[model samples]
Target: MALAKLGEGANTGCMTQTDDSLRDHFLVASPYLEDAGFHGAVVYLCEHSAEGAMGIVVNQPLEITVGEVLDQLDIRRERPDQPVYAGGPVQTERGFVLHRTGGDWHGTIPVSDRISLTVSRDVLEAIGRGDGPRQYLMALGYSGWGEGQLEEELASNSWLVTPADDDLLFRTPDESRYAGVLRAMGIDLNQLTNTVGHA
Candidate 1:
């Protein structure tokens, strides 16, 4: 949602990726994306097949009420409580689950057969009642790539491919996520830049 932006509109400088291989990779926005939701962002690639690519911004946390989202689905929580995450720049009203599978959950998107995304309000209700999945995250909206868009950006050095880690998803705090990923890469925060074409 707009909360992820903390800005007034879409970034005029966001580079589109144009390579096939980079589709399933992650985009760690350079220090140059420092004015909005993308500032120091770390995106996780959810799809990278021939058709298209998709992901979610992992670092930005929103101030929205998860209960509000549940209510939209007509599911009520006996005791509402759970943090909401900024997924990306698509349908902010829709719900997406980035979590481990099982335990009475429904309406999931299979990121991998082993790992899935459950987006229905039932999941949220269960979570609010302390009966949610073993581990999960609620994301509103998502980042999408069409055809050659991701490839173009990857060729320009706009993203980095890394294995998605559960610890990074569930344990890291919002403020430090992007920096943490860079640290894992043995790169210092001072070394990245927004100039993708030259990188």
Candidate 2:
């Protein structure tokens, strides 16, 4: 499965705890997480288990557009312009698509009842023909945590966990998503601090 391929090169030696999976959740970067790559980032978890966690950063859109990517890959395009997100710090050369689940694709991993992750070009080809998933977030690369890395970070309060919302994930504006999640949780931005607090 495409999701299993995510751990192919990882050597974190993390356990595989399917029952404790955090799949389909959102990882909102806490203010205390000062890493330039993740500061104020909003990640949608695609797969999470004891082996590790993998997700896509949905709030950071690159200047490059879907049209540009299609042109670069020589895929015909009939759709309107769409921004491509910078998914994470790993595998930046590869592309990943998070879209509303429906059509069958060659390389697809279901993230939830409503979302699936596709790493093959066939979906892009379909999009080029105006027949892809109705809503999608196209990105390059993806955020990943090996072994217990994510747990340690969570222990240190680096991320605010929240249930994944389709409206926030697919329909919310990129710039507003970070605060939108907070708002949905009734959190005031000014109240956020390094101190641990449940979302």
Q: Which candidate's lDDT is highest?
A: 2
Query: Residues 92-170, candidate 1, lDDT per residue (tens digit)?
Result: 7566767775665545555654456555555666766768776777777888877667666666655655766667777
How badly does each model clash, as a count of residue pairs? 11, 0
Query: On a 0 to 1 TM-score scale, where does candidate 2 land against the true structure?
Result: 0.88
lDDT per residue (tens digit) for residues 93-153 in model 2: 7788899988987777777788988877788888889999899999888899988899999
Error of 2 at 131 (Å): 0.7
**Listing every candidate in turn, what is its Cα RMSD in Å to the true structure after a full C-alpha superposition?**
7.7, 4.5
In terms of lDDT, model 1 sits at 0.64
Q: RMSD (Cα, Å) of candidate 1?
A: 7.7
lDDT for residue 92 in candidate 1, whole number 0-100? 73
